[model samples]
Target: MNYFLMLSNSHADGVLSWYQTLRLEGRMCDVVLEAEGVKFPAHRTLLACSSDYFWSMFQDYTLESGAHTISLPALSSKGLEQILDFIYTSWIALSPSTLEVTLQAACYLQVTPAVDLCIEYISESIALDNCCFFANIAAHYGLSKAFTVSNSFIARSMCRILVAEQYKAELLELNLDSLQEVLAAEEMPGVKEMALLQLALDWLEYNPQSALQSNALLCRIRYSLVPPDELSRLSAIEPALCTPFIHSVVHKALNYHLQGPLQPLLQSVHTSLRTTNSKILLVGGGPEADRPQNQILAYEPRTRKFRPLSTTLPTKLQHQGVCVVGHFLFVLGGEVVKVDEESEKSAVMTVTDQVWRYDPRFDQWEEMEPLLQKRAQFTCCVVEGVIFAIGGRGQRGEPALSSVEKYTMNAGCWRSGVSLPHPVHGQACATEGTGIYISGGIYGNSPDSSKDVLFLHAFEGDAWQRRASMSIARFGHQMATVRGRIYAFLGMYEPFCDIEYYNPEQDLWTHLKPLLNDRFCYGLMATGGRRVLVFGGRKWQEGQEVCTTNVLEYDTEYDAWREVCKLPGPLCGTQCAIMTIQDPPET
Candidate 1:
């Protein structure tokens, strides 16, 4: 019986002849068997087989049955000859059109050497005209060298052909240097020079330092394209690049090109900003009031001011789980109280599990489902639109909770996550890029706080790791990141004048000037540009705690603090959220 199979041209690269001779001599009979009519079966035992037979057999096998089958496609005589040649000699050369199909077949057959040779040939043959399509395929298959070469070729050619006047700005999206090289090569006598200048100016506006080192190169090209007078006129372009150039003029800037650290604390803040920068809705209590009067305050960073936000809560609340996502602020469980008029009696306040959302657009609040477990003194942060409620002491005299629950913004549902490594209350939680940093809170049974900084990285991924400890212990302290540095503000502990800064990159902490007023549990918000605003918190004096309504602002640039605005009323346990907006002050 004779068996015939179709082969791809790519398999014609010369290993098949030896295998064919062995099969014909019946030396490989144990591994090579005859199937009915024009097809030979590979005896599952033969380690080596002709590429053509392998490709055909590969396409023919069904993984479902876990067995090999002889299946061949109908082919012209020429195609059949190529198949036989590859089966006998292990290699076949063919046209580009035929090569593409064979390449796919070779890959399917697990023929490594043949597939690689075809890819190399394609890469060498790629040109500007066919690069786009070829590059797409190369990128999809993770053929790095092929993709880069094809893209570079197209970019280089585009630069050479398109004149300054005819240059397509969309081409800038390709490769910057290649585009610049192309522009440099073209000789434009008229409006072409002006167009090139305009394109360069726009690029410099968006990214100044990107091409900083290449300024001399750009200047030389400019001199060639335009007269000195015209080049000088283009100097006053917006989004000035002159400053950066001057800053690096003295010395060549270090080209370390180092990537920023994947800090958990830093990632948390970035994640929050990307998810939403809507109106910050603050929830807290009024001074000395039972049935804490919950109020929402909104601040626009652009204007650098605050405005009261309207809410629809049936009663006031304080010490609530507050988190902002998109345009909505989710305010969870808090405490409130009732007063008796007939007997002038006061009672222990009642805790609530009510949840409310504040919409900035309408300045309105809507009621939502309450928490399954009521918590106060809890901290909440949003990660990937999911609000995580962490360690907060429950109702009065209730045990502190290590239970971590996550509220999904998309599903409008709450689910439990990996509990905290340690339960602590009055902790300051800050999110940087993708990680959450939970710093200094009351950890053990004792009220004595911890200086240990607990770092939870990629909290959504169930990975938690601790980092270096803080220089000082703090609870009810506020933490904010400005200029890539973390500032841990005043909080309760032995040191009454506690204020510290943490540098995650260095894994070191430095002490900053203490707050003008020593206080703990203040509403801290980073606002305007680089200002850290401290609202209200309790002040401890002579073993007594007093709530203060003073508002102080810390300038990160100057590393100094100055009192800004005072609260309308004395407040404690109030939420303060700040959002940045656009619009510069009138000069």
Candidate 2:
């Protein structure tokens, strides 16, 4: 049997303590390590056992193998002394002022314990004040953990660092790779992509030789988030951004802005927002009382909570056609209700041709070119980069208008398109692929709603082609395209909870699971894939029509409906859109 002997931890510590005492007393020293005129007398065996640098140097057939003294000109005296103390005592004192020099000496001497201690101290002590300095040293020494921590710190503080004058020098001092890493992060609050673009351009202007890295730096910008007008202006003046590579990137972004209805599906690195928190924006609407409100609420789906946005509509609008082109919200052709000052319950509804575009980037609204005709209760759908406003009521008590107007973004004008098969209002519109489909609505001079469906493919300057009609006629209903199929939900003039989907390929209509309760005039949108979310709407209860706050989700795959939650309050005639908003910084 082999005999094994091992000393206890306390006994082992005692031996190291004895060696340290001997070194401190300047007795039995075998080598003198000198740096910057400062000398440390230590045992060769102890240094060789503690550091790989000393171990390899003191080995046989080496330059310093038989030497009694070694000079290290690359290290500082104070840093060398601190490292030597840790090798024997197993403790090191580190401060922000001395951390750089100390870390350099430990890394140069291959003292792993001291290096690890210095990194740990840096990781815990990182702050906005010294983060850039720490990042520079960490990158030079190839310290991955330290580099990552310090780099992330700079990115998270970018909003403050960019605006504060004190950090201008530090920001300009960042290396190319470090600056790219900071700009690539999306966690910066209160900082927009346009500002980031300017920062990159400013850096390029300051460091003219860095033009070679212009493409790499510019690619970090989410150009889709920038306004098209501003992007066009910048491209004209900034020569560096006009390079072939950057030009192609910018072209892709400009095209993405015109996608409209298809923007959600065409998301890319350039188009995707820099925010992780996306909220559903519920635009202007009214209650069952027919009084439209101007409040806009942002609903967070993850938390199932609602918060009002700081920006609201310029004026109260109802039955408006809402659509998002790029990051802008367009509210067009709605009835502006003016409540009577004396008669609290009475109000006058005036049809307006005014068009308002809301830019979330600046939280400001601009009056765009108004519609060609004043209308309300119309349905708007974007196809092939054009917004088509379909049939609606022109004047207050007039018959439904069959005229259609097309708004081309590039032209900034609304032109007449082919008329509908017949004048209809309260129709639900949806875009399937590149085709625009309008479902059941009230026809001209007809007391009852019709189930007739109309289709216009590619907007070929042709008349509406009649498609398969729904099983039941729907008016004031909602229609959405999910998983490439058109789904029509229950609406007014129809008390049934029946839900159905239209198959264009088959030219057929099939009934799916019916809703638990009948709803109409509700805010409906396709979250993604085969799922659809429905917000507040008016429902019939106890022989009376009332507004409901119930929020329901429909899953086409399961053919089922369930109440997910409730809106902040009962809202009808509202428009809901999914938007990416920056999350508030953590306290």
Candidate 3:
């Protein structure tokens, strides 16, 4: 019988240390590695053990196996010296200035540990000045982690890198593939597509040798989004862009503007807005006691400016359910107020079952199949590509509806769905993942709003399950899901400023910071991360209801609210959605 004994990992480390000392002292060395007229003496067996390149070369079958010296002209002497030190001591020093040569030597010698070490250093050491260079090198060597980190850094810092005079040379250093990757990214914060187009054109001008790639580079631009005015300016100045390909592209964009209401039907890559171009759209709202405004206003948070789109709704609608599906905006059952022609000046508000779909691609609105039941003040949500219209009031005298209806694009028709536990109207509804949630609305014929919350696992079943109730009863309010949690904003009349959020996992509701001012019939929209925006609405002031233009933004992360900006006009009974539309020409 024999006992097995283990010498700890320190023994191996000691052996490496002893070998390193022997090589440094030029003791018992077997081979000499040379680069750039510099020679390094080392043990052949130790070099073979450390690198696959040396291991194969030292084999008996190889010409270098019998030789006492090996030449590595492709590698820098400094890089080889550093790599050899790491092989002996299990440590290496890397700096931005020498990273390229070091990584090159590691890759050339098939020293994977050193290669990974070099990659890690480059990833952590990326800076504005060297990020583009790192991206190029990592891309060249197919070093995925370094490539991804460097490209992400470049994209995030592009806004500064593009405008700063100091960074221009560095930006210009990006190769064709790297430049294309940077330009095509949608995460460039404030860098608009036009700016990217200008950058691409500048890159081409700077690198005249890349002129043959003009079409490939320029086509990444969403030409239709470049404002026809800018296109005209570019056409006049850039003789290089006057090619037939660019000319036709410009023509198509101008024609898109000409199409006006027909833009949706002619959707294309050139006409599609980047996700970064998404704006908060205030839909179908107007001054109190006035006809609902048909002209949808787009509110740009970055600029804090509002612009009304050229395309107006087919009808002025209020209390409508709005949802966006795959770039298409659907307006469901709503109250359409029109002037009573027989009564001369009086307005008649009629509940409509008509549905309309707005296609931003062409700025066109098309009437779709009517809802199964005529309802207003209902809530609609999309899940699994199907649209579900929930409880609402039907007509003027009819009681609030407990019935539900769903519409599918495949069927192209509305069908009945599972009824609500109780008829409710003026409720706030929102969806997260595959879950549909409705909370805080008046139940049937009751003047008081209910704090009850109901949920349905959409696509899984028709049953509605009761969840945690909200802190306050709300009506005509809005609900939005942000960061996987549902938030309820202020509604009408009672509990003027209370706001709350729900956590589905815990089935609980917690009060959040209330609004600075009390308002109702407003548009509530959630965008980006943990921020909810409240658009135009009506507020009670001096004993009279007055329309307000105030826009409030809530920061869930900080549990606070602040007035960011104001809407274009005082309006209420409106809905808002974040939409990617063509960018207007810059002033």
Clashing pairs in 3: 263-362, 264-362
Question: TM-scores, in order shown?
Answer: 0.49, 0.77, 0.58
* C-alpha lDDT values of all predictions: 0.57, 0.84, 0.83
* Candidate 2 Cα outliers beyond 4 Å, as residue runs: 1-52, 68-71, 77-95, 111-126, 144-149, 162-177, 180-187, 192-279, 286-288, 300-307, 493-496, 540-551, 560-569, 579-587
Per-residue lDDT for 1-587 in model 3, tens only? 99998769798899999999999899999889999999999999988998999999899999999898889999999999989999999998988878888888899998999989978988788887788889988988889888888878887787778777778777776778777777666555545567777888888889999899888777677777676788778977986668889878877887876664344446666665544568888888888755687878888888888988878889988888888765678899899988776874688788999999887754668888899999998999988778899989988888999999998776778999889989999898888898999997889999898889998888786699999888787888888899989988888875458888899999988887777778888888998778888887888889888888888888999998888887767888788888787565322
Query: Can you tell me which runs of candidate 1 are displaced by over 4 Å?
Result: 1-281, 289-291, 299-307, 339-347, 540-545, 579-587
lDDT of candidate 1 over 459-538, digit per residue (tens)? 54575577778888877777887767788887764455767777788888888776655676667777647888777777
Q: Give, for candidate 2, the lowest lDDT window spanning 10 residues.
A: 260-269
Off by over 4 Å in 3: 1-7, 236-240, 264-269, 276-576, 580-587
RMSD in order of candidates: 24.9, 5.7, 10.6
Candidate 2 residue-wise lDDT, 493-551, digit = tens = 47668989998899899999898787887898888667898989888889988988888
Candidate order (lDDT): 2, 3, 1
Candidate 1, residue 567: lDDT: 71
Give the best candidate by TM-score: 2
- Best-fitting candidate, scored by lDDT: 2
